[model samples]
Target: MSVLPLVFTSGWASGINAYAVVLLLGVFGATGLTDEVPASLQRTDVLIVAAVLFLCEAVADKIPYVDTVWDTAHTVIRPVAGGVVGALLAGQSGSLSDITAGVVGGSTALASHFVKAGTRMAVNTSPEPFSNIVLSTAEDLGVAGIVTFAVFHPTAAAIIAAVLLATGLAVLVFLWSRIRRFLRRRAQRREEKRLADGGRIPGRAGPPPW
Candidate 1:
């Protein structure tokens, strides 16, 4: 069977939580759940690194501003991970060209990453941290569930992932205003901090000269 479905699903999941996807796939491969997983992904060193990163993300993703920072840091990492995984999957299955799989995975991950990042920015506009925690937990579960499901039912998982990606994009579009507000507020905060740290120069308390 072709590995496109799994590649697509993994790409979408990778956008939200690349380490989790890697960790889960590695575990599955090591356990002999499936032979489709690449040997490189199942290495002890790779599993350990992925597990550590997943733990870090699981913690950092539940904090509002921290999640946004984490997302910013992974903007490149996620897409690159997706492409590499896709290429490996293709190489193992011999069902598609590595370049083709890599491009599809990387582009899908990039799109979904935008949706995740934009939604998080909008969510950060909320005053409380509970929402972030809830959303983060949901994303982690979703990534885990979908990737595991893909191991057993690739086509079905891909369809579900497509729906999720579409829904997330729609929600992000609806929340564009909130995302913009968050960006503006964040910029203001940075400017305020900079000014505070730099010590503003004294000035006359009068209107500027016309």
Candidate 2:
């Protein structure tokens, strides 16, 4: 029972939604639903704090600009949480050094975090808010499902996480240029719209009436 699979899976999930992973693991550990989970993670204080943060994230993550801001703020927090959780998982097995697990978790989380943040930024270029809400909800669900599965089937979950991470990165790379162009076009459109509406563009005077 190498904890590597759980470490990777949890790290990936944490990048997307660390609080949810914490809340789910804590709840499962507290209820004796999962023996692999660490006791400290099951503490009442940990659960409460995770729940509160999760709630806040749930709301903030559905707002376009706000979600980006929230993501920026959490650029460090999520990876650290991933490392901590990974270490805790390793501690349960006592077969691996906590430092090793922490490195794996932190590195995996950082990769996934960049993917998530970049995708969210691209999605935010759209003016509609529903896409943000939908994407956020999907991420929350994905984290919950993967973490739950990881508890009982770590190897399978790890495989799945790896596939997903690779696929997402590939897609992002393939579309990177297109995404940048699209965002630029959207910005230009917005600027034009504002000028047409007699709003001044930064560094430019108001447009003359047609």
Candidate 3:
């Protein structure tokens, strides 16, 4: 079977939760459920580490600002993970060039990551914490479902992932205004907090230069 579908699916999942993607793929590989997964992903140490990080992300992703912070931190990590996984998958399957797979996976992941980040920013504008938890839970379930399904039905999973990616991007675009407003408000709050903590405005400070 062509591994392109699985690569795309995994990349989409990784944008939301790289650790979960790694853990799921690793488990699937280790349990003899699929041979398309690379052996490197199935190592005991790899699974354990992925499990630990997945738990951390699961917790961090349910909190409001914490989730945004976590997303910011993973901005690079997720895309990199997607590329590496794609390269590995291609290498294992020998159906596609590793570089081509890596680029496709990384680009897909980057686009999805932007959608996730923008949507979260818009969501965080809400005062309630429950939305964050609900959204985070939904994302986790979605990633798990799509990834597991990919192991059995790669082409179908890829199509589903593509639809989801399109939907997410559309939603992000719809919420772009709200996301921008939220960012402005957040920056204002941060600046206010910094000033409150004795941070002075450049060239307009009252404190002595001592």
Against the unseen true structure, what C-alpha lDDT does each candidate score? 0.94, 0.90, 0.93
Q: Is candidate 2 or candidate 3 better by TM-score?
A: 3
Number of clashes recorded per candidate: 0, 0, 0
Rank the candidate models, highest lDDT first: 1, 3, 2
Q: Write the per-residue lDDT of candidate 3 for residues 62-160, one digit (tens) a residue.
A: 999899999999999999999999999999999999999999889889888988888999999999999999999999999999999999999999999
Candidate 3 regions off by >4 Å?
200-206
lDDT of candidate 2 over 83-105, digit per residue (tens)? 99999989998867899999999
lDDT of 1 at 53: 96
Query: What C-alpha lDDT, on a 0 to 100 scale, does residue 199 get in candidate 3?
Result: 64
Ranked by TM-score from best down, the candidates are 3, 1, 2
Count clashing pairs, candidate 1: 0
How well does candidate 1 match the true structure, expressed as C-alpha RMSD? Answer: 4.1
Candidate 3 deviation (Cα RMSD): 2.5
> Candidate 2, which segments miss by more than 4 Å at Cα?
178-210
